[model samples]
Target: MEAQVINIMTYEVIGSKDKAVAVIAYGVKTPKKLAKNIMKTHKNIKSVLQKTGERTGVYRIHPCKLLAGNKNTEVIHKENGFSIKVDPQKVYFSVREAEERQHIANMVKSGEKILIMFSGANPFGIAIKKKHSDVYITSVEINPAAVAYANKNNKLNKINRVRNICADIRHAKLEKFDRIIMPLPETAISFLDAAYHFAKKGANIHVYTFNRSFNEAARDVADTCHMFNIKCHKVGEHKVLPYGPGIYKFRIDLKV
Candidate 1:
C-alpha cells in the first residue's frame, strides 16, 4: 500500500547523492492535502533524497531567519534539486560551523594558502574569503555540477578570491596547502591520503569522520597517520552531526 502523503513543516535538501532531498520532520499522520499544499507553495523542492556511498544526503533548500519578526526565511536556488523549507531554524548556527568559519577567517589574515577538499559549493571557504582579503583559497569539489554552482554562488555573493577546482580530490595533483579542510565525514576517512599529499608538514588539518565511538574514530585516524610515519596530534574534537545516541559525526583538528 502506498503510504499516505504527509506535510513536513521541516525539511532539508541533501546533495551528497543523486536526487538529494529529505523531509526531516513533521507531525505524525499528516494528510496528503497538506503535503500537496506545501509542495505547491514551495515549488522548488524535489522529493527524492539521494544517498552517496558516504551515506550523507544533501539539502537543496536551506532556510533560516536571521532577523526578528520575519515570518520565514528560505534559501532556495537552482544549483541543486531541492526547495523545501524548515521554519524557525537558526539561520546561522553558532556551532562547529561557526567555529570553522572563524578559523577560516583567521587563516586568511595570516596569509595562509588553504585548500578545501570535498568542498560542496565551498560555503565555508567563501565565508572566510569574504571577510578577509589577504587569503587565497582553492576549493576542490568532486562534482562538476556542484563546482559550477559554487562558482555561481561566488558571483552571487560577490566573492572573488576563491578558485573552484572540479576534480576527484583523492587524485588531484595540487600544491601542498598550509591548511586543509574536509567536512564530509562519511567519505573523509578514505581521503586521508589525499589530505596527506596536499597538506604541508606541520600544517593544520581539520578532518571529519564517522564512527560509533568518538574516541575510537579519532584513534583510527591517528593510527592511519602513524602507519605512514606521520606524527599527528588531535588538537580538538566537536560533534558536528548527530547520527545517533553514541554514534555521531566528529570533526577532529590535527596538527601534522
Candidate 2:
C-alpha cells in the first residue's frame, strides 16, 4: 500500500541532538531563537502552557494555528523552495493561503495597491509582490516578532513592493485598497467593520470563515455586508481547510 497523504505541513530539524523536530502546517520555518521566544510568549498567554524541551538546528512549526497544541504537527520537505532561518517549529501553515494571495497578486496591475489585515509575517503581501512586480502592497501584523519576520521575509525574497506595518488593524490608518485579504477566519468576523472602512467602494475582499454549509457561509457574508452597509457577492469557493476530524474551515471570496 502507498503511504497515506496526511495533512499539509512544514517541518524543520534543530539542535545537535537532531532529536528535536520542529513541524509546521504546510512547511514553513522560523528562526530557532524566535521559536523559543514564541514558546515563551505562549507561556505568558496561557497558564497551562507546557514546556517542550528546546533543541538546536531543526524543529517544526505550524503557522495557521491560533494555538500551539491544536496545531498541525506533521511536516515534510520537498525540493521547491525552503528556508532554514525560520525554524519549522515556530511557523508552518501558509502555503495554501500563499497560493490564494498569489492569485490576488496576479490580479494587480501596475500602481495598484492592496491591504492585508492580520498579515502574519506578511505572507499575503509576499505572495502578491512576488507575482506582481508593479503592485504596492501594505501588510499589517500585530505581533512584533511576526512583523520582524515579515520584514525579514521581504528582504529575503528581495521584494520591494510591500510596506510592513506593525500595528493593530483597528488603529492602523489604512488607505483604500484595490484588493484586501483577511485569512484569519476565527477572528476576522469581528473586524468586518474595519474591513469595510478600509475597503474601496468596489474592492475585492477575500475572507476565510468557518461555516457548516455553503449557504451558512453565504448568509454569514450577507450578514456581515449588511452590517457594513456594503453590497457583497461570492467570487469563488476554495478548499475547506481541515481543523480536525469532520470540522472544516472554508475560504470564500467576496466582491464588495
Candidate 3:
C-alpha cells in the first residue's frame, strides 16, 4: 500500500531521536490532526510534540505539548558521535546549534582550560572535550535540572575532564581559562567583563549574540573588549542561526 502524502508546509521537525519527533507547526489549524498525520507518514515517529512558546529565562527552556504517541519528554539526542540526554521542557538544548558547537570545538588548542558560561546540558563542553581530550573544561549553569543532566550526560558520554558546576556565572568563583565561551546570545555581551576577568592572557573568547548584522555584533564585541581593557583581535565572525525575520544569532570569535 502506498502511504498518504501530508502537506509538510505547515510544520517542520525541530528535533528527533529513536521513536520521537518534535515539531513546530505554523499556519496549521488543527495541530493534533497534523501530528497524527505526521505519525502516519513517518513510521519511526512514535511520539510527536508541538513547541508552544519561545525559549525563555536563564535556563532557556521552552514549553511543549504532546500531540501524539508516548508522553515522555526526555530523549537521548546524539550529535557529533556523542549522546546527550535532554528534557526539552526542563532545560535548553538546541539541536539546531550542533554544528556551531562543533565549530567551537574545532578551534580549541591542546591543554587549554576552557570555561563555558550557561552550559545547558553540557553539550558545548562535552563537544570540546570529545574533540580535544587534553583540554579541561569548566561548565557553569544556574539551573539545577540542567546541571543534573550535565553530570548525567558527562557520565553517559564518559567525559571526565569537564567539571559541571551548578552556580550562576556572575557569582561563581572561577579560575582563569585559556578559552571562554558565552553561548547565551541575547545577553552574552552583558557577561563580557566576567568572561574577561576569568580569561588567561592570549586567550580566545567566543561570544554569541543576536543582532541585525555581523558589523553590529563586531562593534558590540569591540566596545565590550575596550571597556574591559582587553585588546581583542577579531578572529572570525559566523552567522550561527536566524533569530527572527531580520535578526540573526552570530558568533564573534576574538583573540585576547
Best by lDDT: 3
Residue 183 shift from truth in candidate 1, angstroms: 1.4
Question: Per-residue error at 237 for model 2, in Å?
Answer: 2.2
TM-score of each: 0.67, 0.67, 0.90
User: How do the residues 1-256 of candidate 2 rate in per-residue lDDT, one tens digit apiece?
Assistant: 1111223343322211211233333323453444465446433211111223322221122323323332433222211132212323344233434345546566666777788887766656666666676888888877665677778777777778688898888999878987788877775766777887787877878777877777777678778778778776778876556655555577777777
lDDT of 1 at 22: 33
- Candidate 3 backbone collisions, by pair: none
Between prediction 1 and prediction 3, the one with superior lDDT is 3
Q: In candidate 1, what are the lDDT values of residues 147-241, reduced to their tens digit?
A: 76677667766667789898878667789888889877766766776788888888888888878777888898888787766666888776665
Deviating ranges (above 4 Å) for candidate 1: 1-10, 13-34, 37-109
Better of 2 and 3 by TM-score: 3
Scanning candidate 3 in windows of ten residues, the lowest lDDT window is 1-10
lDDT of 3 by residue, 124-212 (tens): 98888888998989999999999999999989898787899999999999899999999999899888989888988888999999999
